[model samples]
Target: MINLKISEPNPRESVREYAYRILSENILDLVLVPGAAISEKEISDVLSISRTPVREAFIRLSQEGLLEILPQRGTYVSKIDTEQIAEFKFLRITLEQAVMKLACSDFPQKLQEQLCNCLEKQSICVKKRNHEQFFIFDNMMHDIIFTGCEKSYIWKIIQEANLNYARARVLDLSSRQDEIEVLFAQHKEIVKAIITKDTSLGENIIVRHINKVISDVDDLQKQYPEFFK
Candidate 1:
């Protein structure tokens, strides 16, 4: 098993919240990694927080599907459940496409500018070959697009679902230069489609983008079946 290292806590963070964010990010980034065993005391000591907060965080993460609490075996970073990932992908694509369609009809100038900035950052990340930052910007781009649709509740659900699938998508980032380039091109097209109020074009591009991620998951599962549940 990999030895997970937790960071020192910030003075401003509540112990339970800090533990939650740290553990959640680690899981999404695959740093704690899937199927890894976890000890509350070990995490508490490493983060310099008490076991109580760590336990609270564990329970929260378990509720979020990021942790598995086995009775005698103890808590573990949850395995990658392909079925869940598929469900997440389906929901994200379906809801996000609907949002894009709505945004196409009622394109707002402010939202477009925000999405433009995100796309700019995405370009910079690509130029620098910074995968982590690229992913962050990619998320911002989607956030701007989806949140602009005024469907806040659905947008929030998409965020949680995307987090569940993000690690697998990130793993597929290595040496995916051509695919990455196509993504930026598609982003531009999507933006243009929205700007021109072309709902069909926007829907098509977003659907293709999401399907590509699903395809990548298939590639990953084939390459490393052990990493998945």
Candidate 2:
């Protein structure tokens, strides 16, 4: 189990925001596993805050479908819903393809440089066996593509909608740590396609790259059944 550190609440940020950020990070880090019971009082006590703020945080996470606040039982990390995962995958792919199509046509030099830097950073992450850093760099590369297309809004929606898929990707990353090289290769191809302004090439590469992020859902579901519904 990962140890969670409670951060000091910033005066500029409300207690609920602070609690929410901390709790969200912890949950994503799996310090609070799915279906694990959590109480507003315990959280408030631990964070040295009042119950109201903790309660508010719980409400927000629940709204995000990341938590389940039972009426009388208690609040718990929500189990991953595979149906939602599939739905998000479809929605994400559609919007991303549109974004990539624009990016393929525009193919700005600035974004290409950014992507090259991300690819280099991702390569270093692979060498260091740093899954977390690899994931961060991966997102940055994709975000740069979105920026190139002037569609960061779509990227934000994709991020907000794919929490379960994100965690599942993390699990897949752990099992296939060596697969980072292949992922980096795919990223390189996408970048090259974009740099050369090859629309069809970019389309093929980007779809394959994005789909690879969730291709092993069945295996992952089998491995981490408790984390899923």
RMSD of each: 2.2, 2.1
Worst 10 residues of 1 by lDDT: 1-10
lDDT of 1 by residue, 1-229 (tens): 3355467668898878898888887888777877788989888777777999989999999998889999998988887787887888778788878888898999779999988888888898778888777888887787777778877777677777665578777766653766667777888988998889999999999999887777787778788776788
Q: Which residue ranges in model 2 land beyond 4 Å of their true spot?
A: 5-11
lDDT values, one for every candidate: 0.81, 0.83
- As for candidate 2, its clashing pairs are none
Which sections of candidate 1 miss by over 4 Å?
1-12, 175-177
Candidate 2 lDDT over 1-229, as tens digits, reads 3246666767799777999999987777666877788888788777878999888899999999889988878889998777887887788778877877888788778778999999999989989988878988988998999988888887888889888888777777877756688788988898888888888888888778767867778877888888888
Cα TM-score per model = 0.90, 0.91
Q: Judge candidate 2 at residue 94 and give its lDDT.
A: 86
